[model samples]
Target: MGRSPCCCHDAGVKKGPWTEEEDKALVEHIQKRGGHVGSWRGLPKAAGLNRCGKSCRLRWTNYLRPDIKRGNFSDDEERLIIALHAGLGNKWATIATHLEGRTDNEIKNYWNTHIRKKLLRMGVDPVTHQQLPPDHHLDGASASLLPEALLWAAAAARLGGLDTGALRQAQLLQHLLHTIGSNNDATNLIANLAAANSVLNSSSRIVPSHLLQDQMNMLSGTNYLQPGYLCNTTSNFTEQDVVQQQLIKDMSPGTSTFEAAGPADQHCNTTAAFAARDVAPAVDMLPVQEFAGLMEPMELQLPNLCSLESDSFWKDLLEDGYRL
Candidate 1:
């Protein structure tokens, strides 16, 4: 491993951190010596300071700079800092953009001291979107204790068991579109979403509606609509049929609405419900031919008698299928 650095590395150089005397000297030197604010690497040499350029620059910018804002932080500023951190995460540079006159270090320190505790008190897990354990305490915990990415997984579980693969593909396509600054990549995203169970079963699958609405909601940008070709096909299905199937599924927990909705939503619950409500049922209920078009064709395969042997014979014959 490499050795650690020390402020006293060089002999005959003013070592250690910048002091009040050194700060005054540097300030006076800059005021009296009228010259350009040279590159950071050359500032120490120009200012007659023995410190490294990085150290000198930091001391000047963070502590001695004229534009530096110092004093107690305000409550509104503190709340803004918390919101920025929650939304954008550990990007101090980006967070600093929202905070006027606040350095990254100062915001970082304030987060560590005050806002972090406030988040804990609000039953909000600062990192994950879950509740923190009541008995467990945070003494030596860092911000990493709450990783934000886990929120995606939690949200995925809530949003009808979203497929991780589909979500990732949708995200990548969105990012690609954003990078190229166009909507051409939207086709692939729509195809992926239409193939998923979530969109096919949603009430919004009705006409002219974007198939990738869910994905767009997740990504926060990119209004990737399903292609007009796909939407045109979906127009064959009506909104009321989709709603009824969803209501049925919501009423019946065990079954999927896909079977009830059929290939087109217009064919199922809407037509059936309407006909049953409007026309009188014959004393003899109508035969299957009345609804033959609405039903899926069933496969009829007769089992061979040879395949239906005694349980004892099959048990012995299928013994190899069992494992230890």
Candidate 2:
């Protein structure tokens, strides 16, 4: 037998947005009952609201609740959304639990209307949170350089014992770089890059890996580094060129260098470097500032290259930056 509906369809119940009078009635009813309305199904009749139980509940939770915060989301909230989304996927209700006074509907709407578009504009796949495919409009060298830069940043992060936040920031920067590289949009790109660079520069402390891993595990409900999760060398540069030119410059002089290889090959090298080096002291660490300095040369060169609009400019930048 089919189950009966919760409310009769022919009850002449009101629907859609609640009126101010309706809000007052609902508020008064709740207040009169000492703020306990009991089951929503019975409360509508008791409160003299000609509305469905579901609609009444939604209105109360989303709008009428005294604790509900209605305003633009702060930067902390935005970052929390991204981090939570990365870990929790599309569990909007679950994500809302971490954010006080924010409803799932509001979170979902904000993500769709604002954050999703921003990530897409930055050349990140909103679904996967990974870099998007190279745009066909990009010059060949430009297309390749962004991916190489990302791979390099990942490598540097792993080598430096940087926090997961640093790694996540690198991923975001990679998205921006990919967008600029593919679309050839230097105007907005430069401004965004400057802002990102400033943020990275202001934070000079090296976060301990174990503490970072613990926090990430707690937030994500998983191990920080699953088996076989290291980043691969995705650049198109030859092995010889990558190894010879891109030696860990920040490491103390006279330390042995390993030829950079695919993720699998480099895992042993990374492990060995960590095991041998005492990175407890901040001086021994490769700061993100040094990495940003490496990118400074590119900033200086972007204006001239962007003005040229020639493939040769991209080719020269890529070749010089990567020492290819």
Candidate 3:
């Protein structure tokens, strides 16, 4: 005899987009529970939904897509999105961290059709975030050769959890300099950065106490620092620096495991080497769940919110799609 079918087949309830009456039931059920309806699977059953857990989840996340701000992108958001894409690459959900209500699909579309062309038009290589070489200067450089600046961007992405494009540009620049730049140039660059920082600090003339407090807050929050800054002289950093170091290490044949030996075995050796040297892991991708919390409207603070009258950018990020 055949075994009993799955619960879904047996249930034989209606499936797909919930009806208005069904929505009422679902909303009522949630309201009764003090507006804290937990678990989509349980929710559907409580509201007499015949749909499966996955369907319910999709409906809520996509259509209901609560806390979703439905508006055109603001200039600041556009800049942030561009900067984030530069730093993070094409990780849309991760990119969405900075733009509330903007879905991954929306951002991906914007990048492919819109933002990318705009950058390229401005002489910025979308992938490298660098300017193209002059027409005559392209003699030695292969058209396909990824820019040296992007190498540092890769290194930065490998070494830091920065956005891929920006990091790639930075990394490429760093590597190229190290490979081709004279010691004097590196020193000069560092000197310039230092000088610029000093001038900015003095000119701003912010209170030292406030500045110190800001620094303290940043160090306490989820701070992203350059790899050089994260180094500790005496500790094995493999566990901590997994994302960044792993990306760089993965690129090399030595770290890429032998075919005969399993990847697990090869990684074991790499891990041991890392432990001995006190080298930490690399930073790369962002977790979606964690990022959602950052973008969630419920958690936004009142003080950081700019007045709607004064700032359209802030307004765009917060407002839902429907006109008020």
Candidate 4:
């Protein structure tokens, strides 16, 4: 036996975009009924429109609603969309819930047209937000060595006596690059490095360690300080101070913390310069001479990257995609 269709496709019912007159009719009809249309299947007839009930409902919900916001999306909205998409996959209807004025259709279109392309260009899989496999011929061993590279960079920045702000930025770049891998293209690599370097130069002011620790504890419920950790009893030093001092001593001149010969040592400065260039619009990267004047001698501490990893959310998004 053949199943019946959900919506009737009568010859009299129109399809496609709605006209101004049809819009007015639907609006007037809803207004007369206190904005409640009892049955969408009966809406077209009651509103004096030649459209299918499904079409009419779509138009009303996506376009003619009084609170519908149109035009360009704000930065906050864009970020919300990305985060939602990351957590929800292509469940546009669910993603739309967090965006006040956006429709599911609109969000779906925007993601396909804008965000997806951007992620691809950045060598990240839009669905997983993970780095794509690199082209080994172009990137060589460096392509697969991102984690080690980042650790070395962070250690170097600390040994160089970089201020806390620069150290934090280095940590952020490390996390971002490791998560969102870059392609082998020279331009892409340069852009990534420039962005990282810019992050360091733009904010040279140090945030108090106690305040940072408090925020971290609130978010992750983990103590920054471990029990029996060596510290001066009278000194008011945070965990950051201890980490920085350790890094400096470990890397100072004759230490085995880092090898003198490696790809990391050879390319660290160039990578930083490139990252700074990529993020130049948001924050300018100061020259070495200017950086010295602006920076203050402060201890460095690595952020708890593990606490920030939303594995369950990404897993759910992947599962949702598979289900759909």
Return the lDDT, model 2, position 156: 49
Off by over 4 Å in 4: 1-7, 135-324
For model 2, what is the alpha-carbon lDDT of residue 186?
Answer: 30
lDDT per model, in order? 0.40, 0.48, 0.41, 0.47
TM-score of each: 0.39, 0.44, 0.38, 0.45
> What tens-digit string does per-residue lDDT give for candidate 1 at 84-197?
454456666656655667777778887778666665654445553233445645334323311112222222332332343333322322222211121123433333333332
lDDT of 4 at 323: 38
The candidate scoring highest on lDDT is 2
Error of 2 at 13 (Å): 1.5
Cα displacement (angstroms), candidate 4, residue 303, comes to 21
Candidate 1 residue pairs that clash: 127-146
Question: Lowest-scoring 10 consecutive residues by lDDT in candidate 1?
Answer: 293-302
User: Candidate 4: global Cα-lDDT?
Assistant: 0.47
- On the 0 to 100 scale, the lDDT of residue 251 in model 3 is 41
RMSD of candidate 1 to true structure, Å: 23.0
Write the residue-wise lDDT of candidate 3 on 179-245 in tens digits: 1211112222233222222332334311233333343343233112211111111023323432324
Candidate 4 per-residue lDDT over residues 1-324, each given as its tens digit: 775454556776677777889899999999999999899887887888888888988999989999888997664466456655554567898777656778998888888997788666655556654345555122232223122222343334332444444445544543444322212223333333433344354444222234323333332331111111111111122223332343344333442323332343223322222223222222233433333322222212343332332434323332333333
